[model samples]
Structure formats: C-alpha cells, structure tokens
Target: MQYRTNPDYWNQWYPSDLISESFPGQFRNWFYSLLVMATVLDNSPPFKANFTYGTLVAEDGRAMHKSWGNSIEFNKAADKMGVDVMRWMYCNHKSENNLFFGYNRADEVRRQFLLPLWNAYKFLVNYAILDDWTPNGETLPILDNVLDTWIISRLNQVIDKVNTLIQNYDPFNATLVVESFINDLTNWYIRRSRRRFWRSEQDNDKKHAYAVLYHVITTLTRLLAPITPFVTEVMYQNLVHSNNPPQHIPFEGEGQGVMSHESVHHCEYPKADLSLVNDDILDQMSVARQVCSLGLSARNQAGLKVRQPLSKILVHMGDYHTELKPEFVQIILDELNVKQFEIVSKVESLVAYQVLPNNKILGPKFGRQFPKIRQALVVADHAEIVKKVNNGESISLDIDGESVVIYPDEVVIQTKPIEGLAVGADKHMTVGIDTIITDELATEGMSRELVRHIQALRKEAGFNIEDRITVYYQTDGDIANVFDTWTDYIKEETLTNELVSGTHAEEIFTKSVKIGKHEVMFGLKKI
Candidate 1:
C-alpha cells in the first residue's frame, strides 16, 4: 500500500564520488536536502503512486494516549465477548463515521438481538419436544391464518430490505432491520401464537403455526449467521438439526426442509420471496396499530386502566385517513378492551370549535383593523366558523359598510372535547374514549384483575405455567358478586377445575388479595 518514487535516481545520484565531493561539513547537509527534493521531482521512470492522510484516533474517536487511559487493548476487548461480537459491532458502523466502542454498546447487541434470537430458538425447541413434533418438510398453507400470512409477509420484506442494504455496503442499517424483525418475531408473532403450541391436541392450525415458526426461526438464523456465527450456530443446531434427521434431505419443490447443515455459518444467505410480501396488508396493519395506540393514549387521559374495558371507541380519520378492514378494527378493539369501535366521518358533532384571529396573518394585513377583526372573531358563531373552515371557505365581516374578508388561514381553530369523553388526536386521526363504566364492565374488569393476581400468585407459589388447580376465595361486598358473574372466565383463565367461595381451611398457600375496596382470602390447590 505504500509507494515511493524511483530508487534508481537515488542510486545514480548517490554514487561514492559525488557523496565524497559534497561530504564536507555543512555542505553534506545541503546536498542531502536537495537529493530528497530530487526524488519527488524525479518521475522520469514513470512509476505510479498515490497517498492518503487522516488523523489516527482510538475507537472512541479520541486521540489515543496511555496517559489519558482512552486506549483500548485489542485482546482485552476480544476477551469480553469474544471477537465475534466486537467484529459484528465494528462492521455495523458506517465507515465514514468514527466508531465509539463501549461495553454498553456490546451489551445492547446481546440484549436487543442475540438474546431474543436465542430465546426464540429455545422456546420453539422446548415446545416442539413437548408436542412431539418433527419437521416432515410439510408445506404448510400460508392462507391457514391471518397471523401466518402477516408473519410470512413481514419476513419476506425484511429479507428484501436486508439483502439490498448489505449489497450496498450498509451493514449498519441491515443489522438494525434484523434487530427490529427479531423484536416483532418475539413480541408479536410468538406471543400471539403461544396458545396454539399450548393446545392439547396437535390440530391442523397448531401444526401450521409450528411450521411457520420453525421456518421463520431457521431463516432468520441463516440471515444473521454471517454477522453472528456462534450464537446462530447454536440456535440452528437446537431448533433445526436436533429434530431433523439425517435422512431428511427434503423433497424438491416441497416446503423448505430442516437444515441438516452442521453449523449456521455454512448455510447460504436467504433470498427474499416477493410473492409473500404484501405491502397493502402491512400498511393496513400499521394504521390499525396507530388507532390502538391513540386509543390507549386516550384511555390514559381518562384515568382508565386497560383491565377496565370501555364500552366504545370513536376513531376520526383526519386528512391522511386509512380505511381499516373489519379484522384490523377487531385488533384495535381487543387491544383496547372496548366492546365496540366506530369510525367517525365527520367531527362537527364530535368536537366543539373555538375561533381566534391569527394575529400573525391579520396584524400586518389590516394593521389598525386587526382589533376589529379579533372582536368579530370572538363574537362570531364559532360553530358557523368551524363549518366554513371545514368546508375550506373564508369568513366575511362588515365594519361601517366596508366589507372585509378573512381566509381560514387567518384564524386558528381549536377543538374542545365533549363532556365525559377523553379525546386524543394527532394529524393522522382523533381517538375518543367513553370513560363511563357500567356494572357489567366493572365485573369483567375485576374478573380480569383477579385472574392476573392469581397468575402472579401461581408463579410465586412455584407452580408451572400449565399447572391446573382448585380455587378457594372468601370475600364480602360486590367482589363476591363479580366472582359469581365471571366464574367461568376466571376458571378458564386460571386453569381452575373447582371454585369455592364460602370458606377454606388455613394453609401455607392461602394469601389475602386486594380486589377493589375489599380484601379477599384466596388459595390455590393442585387438582
């Protein structure tokens, strides 16, 4: 990488007689200086050369110095997580920017990417073993469920984006895409599909769920293998090869076979499946998620907790509106714990309006008349103004028989929420929550809270997630009525086979639980 001009010039010029002629006292120093300059100018031999310069700094972009203690030892860093983690982090940084290395950054990689990936693999392996499932290389139908379609579409999109980013030498964004995908796979896909794996019978839907999960994990492992070899290798082995036999080489034109490869590093990179990538569904889902988010925000404003179900949520799609399908709206309803969802086409009935003169626009245009304009705005029928504004019209005024007109932009419009409703809105849409809680909703909420409390108690009691038990409870007041109303719900949610409400013998597992204003003595016995 280093380059220098012709060495022949140096040899010819530095012959013994010439150096002896000029090697006297100060003359020798003068001769050497000119000889150095001659090398620079001496391109007679036509040698090709280039040079580059930049400041050499430490990993944190600071000047490296032992005195400052900013210098990182290479072997020491490698010892922390091995060279693989450090290498991946290094490759993930943009080359044009300085990389600030720290243990926290490495921990983020482990937490955000590596740990989730490994945990997903472990979850699949453990559940597959419990269900006695093996990969027969069956091509599960994608249309089996909406969740299946959604996840497969997401995976294909990730594959497309990651491949393009890596191809363009942008590993930073590519790794970020992979990180985000891992999060969705763990939090949404697996979390939503857990019941399928937990079901006693291995039905067709359950098998389809398993197949989709296996396909996603193995493909993601392969996708990430290049960046993180060791972790993905361990994942691939446990999730794939542990169950896939050696004789299963996979039939041609069938579903993707379980990878029989010994290590993930030896696998080929994944290619995007264009047919599985549905942008429309993704967009619709994105809008539905926003609605749910805004609805939750509205609930927070109303001082209503999620466990307390609301009667209805009214969504007003603003300028950038989206038509959400019924299924998407159902997701919003379930997430927000609302009995019904309504889409508002017009907000005149939903919102009260106030009009204020825009001083910035009117002040300069009608300097002395600005006060009159402000006065007119205050007394003007605000509802009429709102109607006109919504219709993209201007307001007119008459002072001393001289007519003046003010455009909508000359006024600021503010919305006032109707009484008893908590409203939250952005440019995208407005979400209003009817905060009134009926007796039935209250009972249902209390039932859900009881289920949560018992689940926590189950964990504290050292019982497994699938353990079945008998419930005993003693409560006074409305809590007993709530229990009576939601008995079946509580039983199903808590995996309880028997329910007793009157009294129970004192036992080590008995504990007092607070339900609303009353404290109830509850106990769980293994069935």
Candidate 2:
C-alpha cells in the first residue's frame, strides 16, 4: 500500500530513512524479506538513507544474556541511572562501532558530565534564589568582562557546530560538541564568574553574568531535548516556566524560545547567531587554557599543588599562539595559583637544549659522513634546531659551509634545568615553576590549606553558603603564625565572623589534620 499507485497519499509510508538492528544475517533475514516483497511487487528500493547501528556488548566485550548473568534490562538501567545518562551514552557513540554499554560506563558518564552539569545548574538556582533574581525574558546584555563575552561566543559556536552535524544525521559528533559546551559552562564560565553571583551588589555586571548563564543553559537544554527529554524538561520547567513565561524570545529560523508552552519539548530548537561567534576570542581563550595547563603541569612536576603559591611561572613562547595579554595572564595566575608569570619570547631563554642524533637511523643514512652529521648536530644552533624538531619541521644545519637537513625523527632533544626550576613543555607551550618557596609563600599556602579544610567542614556541617561562622583552631607555634599572618584572608574566604585560636565546644564540626610535623585542629560554628 505504501508504494501503491493512487491519486491520494501514494508512497505515504515510504521511508525517507531506514534504521534497524544490524546483527549478523539481518540483511538476509529482515531486509531480505522486504527485498523479496518489493521485487515481486515491482517496487524500487525505498529508503533515501540507511543507517545501520552496531550491537551493544558488555564493557569487557561479553555479549549480554540472562544465562551469562551479564544482561541488563533497559527499563531497570534507565530507572537506576537516568534516561538522560542512557540517552547521552546512546548519542555519544558512532553508529559503526559497538557501544560498550553497562552500569560501569553509566557511572563514568554520570560522574564526568551529568554531575558537573547539575552542579552548574544548582549553583545558578541557589544563588539566584538568594539574590531574588527573576528572569525578565531579557536577552543577553553586553558586558565588558572577557569571560562573559567568551562564554556567549563559545555557546553560539557550539550551537552552530552541533546543529550542522545533527542536520547531516550525525548525532555522535553533535553530542560530543554539547558535552564540551557543558564543560565550558561548568568549569570555565560558572567557576570564573562565581564571585559575581555571590557578591552583595546587584550591579549590571552581576545581572549580565546571570543572564548569560541563563541564555546558555536554556539554549543548551533546547538542543538536547530531542535526545534526552526528561532532565531538560525538569530544568526548563523550574528555570523558565517557574521563573517567567508568556514572553517571546525570537530565535533564528522557526526556532523561538517558548512564549506559550510549558514543556521544553514544546519549544522550538535554539538557533545559532553566527554573528556572536568570534574565533579571535576563542583562540585567545584557548591560549589562556594552554598556559594554565602548562603551568599546572610545571607545578605537578615541582611537587606543588595549585593551593601552593609559587612566586612565578616562566612561559616559553612559541609562534603557535598570539601574545598573552595582561587579562589572559591574570586568568592564568588565578587558575594555576601562581603569583606572577615571566613569559620569554625565546625558548632558548628557558631551556638549554641538547640535541643527539639517532645513530641507528642516521648511521646507515649518512654512511662515512655520519661523524660530520654528529658534529653538525653538536655545534649547530641547538636552540633553533630543537625548536624546528619540536615543531615537527626539518632542521637545517650548516656544517663547514655544507648544508644538511635533519628531520625530526633523526634527533632526540633534551632540556637542561634552569636554576633547578620544575619545567614542563608540550609542542606549543613550555612553562617552568619556580621551586623556591619563600617563607611568605609557604605561609600563604598553609593559610589556603586551612581555608580549604574550613570550607569542607562547613559543607559537612550543613551550614548555608551565606552563613557566617567562627573558625576555631589549635595548632603549633609555626602554624599559629601563619593563621595570624593571613587571618583576614582566611576569614573572608570562609565567611568567618572571627578566627579563634582556642578550641570551641564539642558540638561544633571539628577535625584534626597534619601539616608536615604539626597537628592542627579546625572547628566551625555557625553564627
């Protein structure tokens, strides 16, 4: 009847896209039966597109079966984990590859993406409630802050990218793109702009921050609603319907923010505003992240956590990225918990590079002239040659007016320590952390440690974020001096009414921690 010649609705049931199980012999079974029927009835091949997905197996590659004790019912899994998590896993993989689906993989997905995403949403809701912020159906406001600008730009970029991929029937890449956007939402935008939300003032800057986050989240949920419906609807109902409805948010194409609808599924998909996408700002932010990554790596190499205050980190500059401005450097400093940065234009200023030719590979290539090549590598401009090699470019050596070209695989380069600083380098960025910890820096680190413990205690004690608490501590003489030195900072960070040196009542939340040779006890009492 689908292919029947009729005046009305002929080929109405003809599939534009055919999707089915791709288990072994399905082509000769289900597909073969259809082919036989079509062949006998004089029908042409029907579908315009056919996407065959692979079968799922256990994470360890076991085919699931009840007898094998590896089978997981879809309904049970959905109930235990979540429909969103299961759907995320489904949309995250290529159709050609067999997905390793199981409870463990679900847990991994929950921890990696879902939890962080929820935390970002929770932060927004909690803080907005405290500030009594209500959505006015207002669009994103222009802000001078780079983080605000960058997040908006990033959101639009992700929208464009995910839409393009999904339009082409590629949900795998589209889902990955959304996952990255969530990371930006949780780690970059919210984490960086948290102070603005927590501050007492309801200035234009704070308003802009809230508006940007709201826009990004609503747009993101609209994009994901087709794939994962429940969580998106829940978030949409609480965030939008409960906050404000009956306002038109005109989007590009037919996709408009819901004006009359209550469910996220009732709303149209979000449209990307390409005009808001700025590659320059994205590139600049990428450079900032690379610097932070390198700085953190240096700190890890130096046996220093991010809480430890380093005097400075040295950035070995390369041509891969633009100059790091003061604004970007400040972000790097805050992220890596370093005091300052010394960016060197020349990498030679950072590393004393030593180049060694691979004898096994070059010996047969250079033959009798191998010695000349070896000496050429030794006396050659080691810095430039190493740079070329690191950049995957061939190194040019002039040995006694004889030109020789050396490929990257032909040599091994090593970096010597400069003043015994801990150094880390990748293909584009190299950074070194100053290992010298002065008394001031150490004391600051210890104070930060105290604040971290106090904040944890507050959370564990069920104290509200805005609750002012008295932090009581008893420590040795050295640790006591650190508290005295940075008491104001600790109090401000922990929202402490006062820092009492003596012990308080046993009813308060208190825990003892060892910092090297000293044992310190910290307690928090809500005021």
Candidate 3:
C-alpha cells in the first residue's frame, strides 16, 4: 500500500518527474512522511501541530508520536491523583488557553480545589447515609420558604448556564458556573442547614433537607460526570447503591448479589429547560451585583469594611430601572450591607459637565457665521438656549456682513456641576457620594468592624458554631461606649453567652489590636 502510493510508482505512471511526484497520492504520502520525520527526528514533536495543521489543511491530523516525548500520558497523572481529579482539571480548562501538561500545576489543583470538592461530597454522603436518605424520583414536596425555592431555582439556573456554555464551547464560563454552584452548596446551603442534617430519628425537616441535598448531589454528580469521570463514578456507586441497588446483571448473571460497577461516564447529561431560566430575573440580579461590586469598591476606597452597615445607596437609572429595579433592590441591600436603599430620579445631581460638539455641522451651513453662533450660544443662559432648542428654532447670528441661522442639532449641550455633592461623571454616566458621616453613623461603622473581628476570632479559635463564648474589650471614649451599647450584637455574632467589657487579662486566648486612637480586646471559650 505504501509502495503503490510512493512517488516512484507515480513517476512510472506519468513518465515525468514533476507530473508524477506532484500527483495527489505522492504529495499526500510525502506530507505524511515529512510529518512523521519531523516528529521522529526532533524528539520534541510540536503538539501545536494539531492547531497549525487544522489551519493549513482544514482537517484534524493524527496524534503526534510518543517517541517524540510530546505525547501526554494521562495514566501516570491519574495514578498519582485519581482519574476523576485529572478529568476535572482537563474539562475545567478553557479551550482558548494552552494547557501545559506537568505535575506541579496538576498537584496544586488537586490539593487546593479538587480534594476539597471531593471531601465536601464525601461529607454529604456520610451524613446522608446515616440519615437513611432516599430519592423516589417523584414530586415529593413544594417548599414554601424563600431559601429553599431560591436554591432549587439556582440549581436549574446552573444547569441552564452549564448547558449553554458547553454547547457554545465556552468551558471557562461553564467551569465558573459549576464552581459557583459548589460554593453555594458548601457555604450557603449546607452551612445554613447543617442542623437539619444532624437532627435525631425521623424528623420531617431533616428528611426534607436530606431529600433536597440528596437530589442536589445526584444531579451534581451527573453534571460533574463529563468533567471528573472516576471520582463521580465512585461517588455515584457509593451514594446511589446505598439508596437503591441496581437489578440487572452485567454479563449474563456473572455475579451473585453483589452489585456490578456502573460507569458514571455513560450517564446522560441533563438538558437545560429554557423555560426555567428567567432572563428578567437574571438581568435584575446582574445589575444588583454590579451595583454591589461598585458599592463595595467604593467602601474599600473609603476604608470601610462590608460588615459595616451603610445608611443607604442611591442608584440612578435612566429608563432601565423600571425593568431591573424590583429584582436588584434586595440583592443590592444585602450585598452593600445597607439598612435601606433610596431610588432617586434625575441623575443630574450625580452628573457634572457634558461635552457638546465643536460646531463642525454648523460650520458648513453658516461658514464665518459659525464663530458668532458659537459665541452667542456660549454667552446665552442655559435654560433659554434649552428652551429655544426644545422648540426646534435656530439661533440667528451676524458675522462678516452676513446673517445666518444655527440649528440646535449642529451643536452639543453639556451639564456643569456647581457645589455640595462629591461628584464624578463620564460622557454617559455619573456617580456621587454623600460625605456627611455623622457620629451615629461612625458608631454604627465601628460596631460593624467589631462584629467582623469577632467573626474572625470565632474562626481562629477552632470552635464549632454551636460553642458559646464571652467577649472582652479594651478601649476608651466613643469606641468603648459603642461596644457597650452594641454588646448584644457582639454576643449574637460570636455565639457568646455574655460580653465582658474592660482590659481583663485572665480570659484572653487571642488578641486583636486595631491601630488607631483606641485599642480593643476580645476572648472566646467553647461551652
């Protein structure tokens, strides 16, 4: 087969060197051999040839040889840290970014993100089995609470996002969506509902929580199956079998009562129901998030932490707020840690100067009169000019022994600010910050900072969430009085039974010193 397609055979058929060697078969064979030689000789065959060859020939070429030392062997990496971990690393990577195969980054990924994810899954399963959880694949119950509905809604949302991203070859966004779901599950859903999972003997709420989480894990494993095959399979086998065992035999009753291994890889992926994804809701949330980020950034610039409560945030919108306002209001309030938000119309308070055109359009019609028109417009009262412009009438000006009319459309109008508000503006938008920080606001801010410190101390003490503690403070003047009044806040935040105010040294396990005109001390104990 090789000889028949060689240039020598073609040479005999055509009886000419150029015509024979230039034939399709000879050319193709020559290209293939050239490629093989390039790989075999260099010992560092370019893996990038896959991309370059597709560009040149508009088709996929064969994989480069392992002899070239460029072939990626998955088995070795998989051996080090399971096939699922490797699969997760590969599938989560963006297609546009070049993926360099090595041990270090892979090890880092496994240690940091992958292992934690696996541990979280394991934790869920352990508790779930102890509770004797099961999913009947039917409409079990409808949740009346907002949090429950929100989580289920969020799950469907992730499904929609993942499906769209994967279908469009945007694995980066898909990975981010998956990461967000995991975060919500671990941080928000599980953390908030931990007690429900640990409840004793046949509690209905506990059962509901188990059912909800079980459904979530099952769906999550199915979703992760494409990305992390081996781990997901193991997780599925353990979790699924514990609840419901398979009935069919693998190969003609090859095994006894022992269940056969089912590959999670073969499991079908979930299709996103577009009807479930509310774009209006998403857009509202998106705007709220944007506002929240901007507000947070603003707070950071002002050296204020997110735990501190703000009086209010004023969001200015031009026509878009009608659609986006209702959805984003609560989100913005929560994210900014504000007591309330005041929506105000007329963004002119936030806006400063607007730039007008340089009379380029009017210059053609009025010629020398353009300069006179510009002068008149510049000198005219803004309100009067605006009125004339709104009425669709042109301003008349005389220059160089000629009179000419200037249309409003020929020039631009801009707003210039004068006093009070701290204003920042661009061509299309503006933002203003109210700088009147009162003593009450300052006390509230200080209280919030104290809350943050207490939360940090709780984490550092290695105390379980249910543990009780007593807080101690060492500060003077307003700072001391602020903590005294907000002692209830401290007790609640730290899960403390009581708060002791003063420079008491006996109960101190950890000390946090805020460098300022004052100093504060706090202590915790597990009860």
Best by the TM-score measure: 2
Q: Candidate 2 residues 374-411, lDDT tens each? A: 98888878877876886789887776688888799999
Tens digits of per-residue lDDT, candidate 1, 55-133, equal 3356567877889887667888788856667867766665455567767777876776777877888888888877788
Which regions of candidate 1 deviate over 4 angstroms? 1-88, 198-201, 247-259, 320-322, 355-366, 372-413, 502-508
Clashing pairs in 3: 353-415, 354-415
**lDDT of all the models against the reference?**
0.75, 0.81, 0.59
Sort the candidates on TM-score, descending order: 2, 1, 3
lDDT of 2 at 250: 26
* Global local distance difference test of model 2: 0.81
TM-score of 1: 0.78
Give one digit per residue, the lDDT tens place, for model 3 in 1-527: 13345767743443211211223334367645655764674443322222111111101233435666545455765787567656656556654444455566567767755766676777777775665555543232355433354556677788878988766656567877888877767766676566566555576676666666665676677777777766777777776644455542211111112333365555557555445445555555545555665566566656666656667666565434544554357656665666666655666544443434356677786676567666666655554454456567775555556765667787687754334334333322233444446677778778877877787887887865446777766668888888788877666656678776655556557676683567776666555
Candidate 2: regions farther than 4 A off: 2-8, 11-25, 29-45, 247-260, 364-368, 396-404, 505-507
